[model samples]
Target: MKILYILCLLISTQVFSQDDSFAKEYFKNGDYEKALFEYKKLYAQSSSNINYISQIITTHQQLEQYAEAETFITELIQRVDYPSFLVELGYNYQLKKDMAQANLSYRKALASIDENPNNVFAVARSFQNHTLLNEAIIAYEKAMVLKPDYNFNLQLAQLYGEQGNIEKMFISYIDFAEANPLSLGNIKRAINDFISEKSENENNVIFRKIILKKLQQEPNLLWNELLSWLFIQQKDFKKAFAQEKAIFNRQPESLLRIEELAAIASNENELDIAKEIYIFITQTAQDANTLLEAHYNLMQLETKQSSKENYQAIDATYQELFKKFGTFSQTLKLQIAYAHFLAFYKNDTKKATSFLEKTLELPLSELQKAEVKLELGDILVLQEKFNDALIYYTQIQRNLKNSTISQEARYKVAKASYYKGDFKWAESQLKILKSSTSQLIANDALDLKLLITDNKYEDSLQTALKLYAKADLLSFQNRNDESIALLSKILNEHKTEPIIPQALFKQAQLYEDKIQFDKAEANYEAIIANYRDGILVDDAYFKLAELYENKLNQPEKAKALYEKIIFDHADSIYFVDARKKYRALRGDAIN
Candidate 1:
């Protein structure tokens, strides 16, 4: 209880001491009324200061005790007439909102200021306080002329802007920009305001042209971005691209913004904008992976119809891209995309073969290799290389193990045998594959099985000979496309029949005939890759090698297929052509 009493007493003393400190600060700063109030609180206890009595008189005048303060000043005037003190007496009238007397007080102050303009700002502040803005402006102008570096012009400009004097406001912003052109936030806001106002008001619209000229005079990165959007709004893509070059050059971080803009353009099929953006991505992005997604998006957006010509250019583009990205092989999407465009658009069999072959040799997992081998086998079969097609299918069969693709490989093996004229063996394979787990394969196997079964009761040999005769007539007339189409229809119409592979082989040969090497290579390789011990393996290999060597300009490339054929199929029909070409390309001294 005694300790509590002492703590309370100490806290009370501290609070009173703090109040006295604040009272002294107010009194010294000349806010006498507030100081007087604080001092009176202490004076009630034991105050006896003559200065405090003098302060009470000053505080009365400041508090509008003009009658009381007049008597107090009368005695002080007899002792000394301070000019600054006289100004205070006059300013007190103004502080009481008596404008007329305040003006009188300011005039008396100026009576001494003719000898000195140093107090002009103080007089201006008096006029400003009195709501005499015009008079204040005059005084400020005079003071500025005398003391040119007055920091108050910034405040004056702000006042003018608030008063809606736009011309002066515009000039102020221009001055600010001149002093600090790098203050982008302020500059952009000011310019945007100017643009909005001018665009709405016809007479003010001239400001747009003026500001545009200024923008062109200094083309920084922000200016570049702004101008590019401006040009785009004006429907000028070429100019937009030209302007955007500065953005990447000056501010590389802006490339991400460019991507977002380009994506918007691409969605609208603004091909020109999308193209520029895609190019910028490859150039400005820190890593190839950064733009790889955009590349894939572009690949998806690319259609076969409208952008066919663009699709055709994918090979050369990918080759250049490979050079840029160091052929890292991790970008499997690039491989898939390149293969798609090459096989469908370029019709380059050897290129497709080489591409898929290299893809097979990549550090891909078993699943990826299996997937790519399926593509490879299809390409081989399209080129009339049945045996090579069988090799791919058989590998998938062994490698894929329990995979659904492995089940589908069984049907492909049947197709390979049928193409090689092994109808009996092919039909036997198709019978088991008829109940394939895959609906498409099952349907195909069933069709081929049915066609063979249906024909067995009739003159099967005669009907097939007729189909072959009709296909040959189309080929003879150089209607290779029509023949290929016809053979495809036959395969589709009689899918499960033993004659499907014969149709497949004929269609593959027709693709080759029409120089549709990609499709032809697919059919040929499918045959060789899927039907390992099938009959057409020899013919498919020889023809595929011939296409590679002659049409595809691939001596080294053709050698692989030919060597495999000669090594694997000694009793095959095209052994002669395969052997001769192999020797010629390899410079093999054949005994």
Candidate 2:
């Protein structure tokens, strides 16, 4: 009797497996009618299987047998009292274009949410699958109200976004973020989708208004932070600083956010506001590191805007900071920034070199000393002391072997050699750096290596390559006008050489920096017109398009150029950014 019972159970299990396999294969192949038949057979054998029942209903709907699907789904609802079945029934009627029945069924689905709030996900998901977003929203809201523990604001925000309701979407996202404060990063990502370059955009305006209303109702620190983020997005650093101040006052936290804002403002050339913010940080910061950073940034900002007339004052400011901060290992960055300012801006490499030497005498670790030596090497290069610069760079490389700084030092050694007209040695160093662990170093090494090798063989004595290297060094020394003149010389003197496009591209960048837009545009256009087959052609296209769009305010020409990049340079590195800009300019709905 026991053996007979075991044989019967094995037979039953085998039959069920066969039916499941048959249904899955047909469904995978889109043979919905056959899949429905097999699933129904399986359901008849095991009426308690929810998976089998759901598959049967979905397959019937896929075959456009809506009445059959509705009948099965209604029966399933009666047998199990599950709310999601009602959603399926409504979707069936919806597919059949029976609006009255669909409305009634959807209302029934929402009404069932109170019976079992935990089933809300299934009900809402079913409606979403059928594109009945409003019905989905109602189901989720009803469930959340019935059970206060049920949090579905994240889903609601996504659904609202799909419905083009930016205000409601942001509100739902804010609610979710407030409930789950650890989800701030996720919330910011969702909100950024609706933002744009134009602060006056409808969605942007709506989002700002919603946050402002929230702030007015109950001035939460989160609201202040969000406002700071929005202002940063709008590139209004002054307003962002105000919001940061509000946050700091309300919470009395560290000045990290203010420091970051100051750095960004300085990077964007909002110097006056950045200076004010840095001053505020210098006053407010409690940590020694933060205070030192604030002071260093202030001096760096001053140096960035310094001229020969104001160099003395800027030098004095650095000296004062150093006097107050002292030359400990912790103050290495400040020391390096001061040295760079002296060498590059004040034209006092003698003092800069001496200052760095004294800094190296401090109690320092190997890496800290390596950093000082790297800056010292840069100063030496500025003073045309190529051999001395190479000595420092090589020492760092030998000491900190296999480190990121070592890779940087190796690249600088190659650059110094290139500037000294030692093409063979520079190319050799760059060859080994092509596979460097640090991507920035690798890229710079490859670029300089290419500039040397590509142009060195063009002339027997490498005259053009040497001149280009000198121009690069001059540019590095902040002699932009002289660099531009030298590049222009190469353009006129080496007409047939392959280096002309590169020289034109470099000179165009310098002109752009000088705010000589017409000359820059002419140079970019010359590259496009004359060297369409060159490697820099795509770069020319992108830069020219940016100039027309931003500086010249010619949208049509910019659009045409972007279109060219999209079609012709599909495999270029700038493809993704070009596509994004093109879509934004074409007025596509970004989110």
Candidate 3:
């Protein structure tokens, strides 16, 4: 008798499982009638299973049988005494457009939360689903008050942001961060939603005031860090430097964060503030390595902004670094920088090559030697010595197989081959590099590969491609005027070819580099108007938008162009940045 009973129980379980699967399949396929029938069978087998009961009600609602859904939910509430059923009942009434009954049911749901604080999440979620956000907020607040351990500040902040209540959002997030200091990273990420483009904007002002007030009341170090972050985002490097100094003063371990801020300032073109920050680091850094790097970076910034007349003084700065650091492997980067400066600015490739070759004799790792060789190869390329440059690049590729440096060397080889008019060899090398580990190298490889493959087939002798290659080499050599003229020839002669757009875009870039904004704008506009369906359309749009926003101060036009990328070119690489710019221009703080 016992064995027969166990077999019957197993058989019954198998039958129920099959029916549950059938119910889910019908629900997924939107066969609500069949779903309801199956769910009813499941409910009869296990009347206490809330899953089956809920599915029965939901299927009825999905089928627009609201009266049936209400009847079922009412019976379930009576049987189970569950508070969440009140919310489900309210949802059904909302679907029926019975606002009075919906409000009553929703109130009952909230009142039930007072009796059982654990029901807060479900009640709030239901209210949120019905778009009754105020009630949801109340439910969350009530839970927090009743149970001090309850923390739903994240949800509250998001809801407050949705309502555009910036102050409340900031307060909630700040409170949450203070309570759970380990979650400061998440809090900062959340606060970024309310940061405006302009630091002086209302939201920024409110945030700054709040942090400042918090500092007065309680000097939490996290406030200082957050303030520093906010200043960096606003590009206020001076203020950020001061805050970072405060942090270092309190901790006194390293100047790493300050060095990073200096780099950020330099990148944003705030050269003066960047120089000041780096100078401070050079003077105050306790470590020799940090001091050396600071000096090197400071001189690099000066070199970039220096004129021909200023090169001698910059040269003196380089000599001072060499004197201080000596010709060691640690000074390899400085040595290479000096080599480039000499080769390009001072126009002395012989000295540059001779100096780099000397530095290669230093006690160095294989990677360090490859670094020096790479720069030397670049200098050789600058001198149009393709064969000599190829020798160096090939050495690196052979020495460091499948590494990032190897991929870089391979790209240089392809570029040098292209420059030397060996299009076939260049195309072959580029094909391998199309999957390079380095994104910059891979992108460059693909661009050069397309430039060759697209134009090589047009002329067997590769006349236009050779000219374009020479133009590209000239541009690399900083002979901008000649590059522009050569590109112009391509445009005028190859008017009906695919290379015209490429030429136009290249020349536009050259014009922008020379600060001739009007000509650059015209060229970009021509590409957009002519090559609407071309691969370069999105590129042209983004470039033109940047020119208008930065050079011409026409934010409206820039916004429209950015919107085009957001709406049309969603697959373009520039979509994320374009959307950010668009939101900034529209004065939306949530970007």
Candidate 4:
């Protein structure tokens, strides 16, 4: 009997092996129906290889045969002692979008309280995907409870964070980090982005503080990155520099960190620290990138307090940097910084022009050329050479029609024209720029346009009054050119309004500001001679005489006008000042 049983067992093994090979071939040919036929033949013979059972469900799923698939998976779940195999049935149901069955399978698999991490994770993922979040949370909890050292806490933390359940994320991070502190990188990165974004929301402050405390414990995680970012946000750049220095110390081989430290130090007004960092980076890096960045920062540091010193320091740095690293494209930044320092701060516009033009021979892109041209235009405008400035500014406009830089260039061109006393042309440029897309630029253009737009009629007295008032407002804002341009606009529109005398007086004063003594004297004298009985006549006669004598050296004409104001207008307020200045100009020494 024993020999017969052994022979039957051997025969059964051979038959099952044959059925398995047939099933494999059928599955390989994409014939799920034939594959199912062979697999079921083995299954009917009481051969329950878990893989065969799982493949049966998978084949049925592929054939959209869900009802038959559920029966096999359900029985397999009941009969299989392998927790992983049981957990897998849950996933198969989920694949069919049968959430109800999937949920039932996952819960059933976990019902034994078998503390297996892989099974717990599988169930958790299924619950998470099926929107059974409470069940997913329980699975994650069970995962931790089964094996506290498995270290999937970061995953759980992120899951909570994704749902905006920040308090849960915080608590999970704390507990997870306490369990495995060395494994805090993902949690640290998540907390970094999360707290950084929500740092300003009042309700999230305490939550951020919790993360910050964790960050404090793990100083190696992102101490410098977070510190530097925090200081930069607060505009406390000096502190950012200090933090960057610590980062450089921790990673001394990092030339990039050294360069960043130097730049941040300079922005913070710690020029000495900036210089130290720059010198160190340049020595170690010894390349064009580090050297040029350091040299540029040195120039900026010197320029912070003194322009003459700024010029000397920038010139020295540029010559040395060019000698060392001029072959690199990065050297252009050094050259550009030095040019700006020379033009605006040092007021050595001739040197600024020279430095900027030298870059013309270098390989510069259209955008770079546009930037240089804009700076050069600013230099020319500062020198009171508006025509040359217009050429540079217009070149940029022709290249980029509707860019923000083009809008800026147009604005500068109009500003230069205003300074040159070309009120009409300046006003035209402003009208277009007032419609610019950039808000701040548009607002400035609108203000300047309003300054010139006061004279709506070029030949109306009311327009002249409005223009004069606009000039006064410009003077209040310290916009001297716009003020003077509006004054000229008023003069063109002056048609004997009740305010004509005041407009003429303002024009004389603005011309004086321009140091156009001859024009100032002419405007003052015109007011006094043409509007003798005008309210500003007494004041105009006094001013006209002062300009003629003090600026033009015509004491005799000054004496004659002062005498007219005192003798002809006895009740005028200028009687005292006019008589007093008249005596002084004639060498009377009246105090």
Winning model by TM-score: 3
**Model 3: how large is the Cα RMSD against the reference?**
4.5
For model 1, the stretches where C-alpha displacement exceeds 4 angstroms are 1-143, 151-153, 182-198, 201-320, 327-591
lDDT per residue as tens, model 1, 247-350: 66776664666676677667655776677677767656776676786675555555322345665465566777667654445677677667755654566768
The TM-scores, one per candidate, come to 0.32, 0.89, 0.91, 0.45
Against the unseen true structure, what C-alpha lDDT does each candidate score?
0.62, 0.86, 0.88, 0.68
Q: Measure candidate 4: CA RMSD.
A: 23.2
Off by over 4 Å in 2: 1-58, 71-75, 453-460, 553-573, 579-589
Query: What does the lDDT come to for candidate 4?
Result: 0.68
Candidate 3 Cα deviation (angstroms), residue 492? 3.0
**Deviation in angstroms for 274 in model 2?**
1.6
Q: Which residue pairs in model 3 clash with each other?
A: none
Model 1: lDDT of residue 348: 71
* Candidate 4 structure, TM-score to reference: 0.45
Q: On residues 1-591, what C-alpha lDDT tens digit does candidate 4 reach at each position?
A: 423533554566555665588898999999999999888877777444544665787789789887787677667556545454445566677777877877676777676445446667546665565455666677777767777666666667767766767778767775676676665565555554444222244324545466467667776535455556555543455566677777766777657755766666666556776776666665666465565666676666666545454457657766776786663456667777778876776667788899789886678888778888888887776666778889999999999889999999999888777665566787899999888999999988986676566444544433453456557646634466888777777566656445556667776787886788887788887886788876667778877777776678888988898889778988876887786666555544112
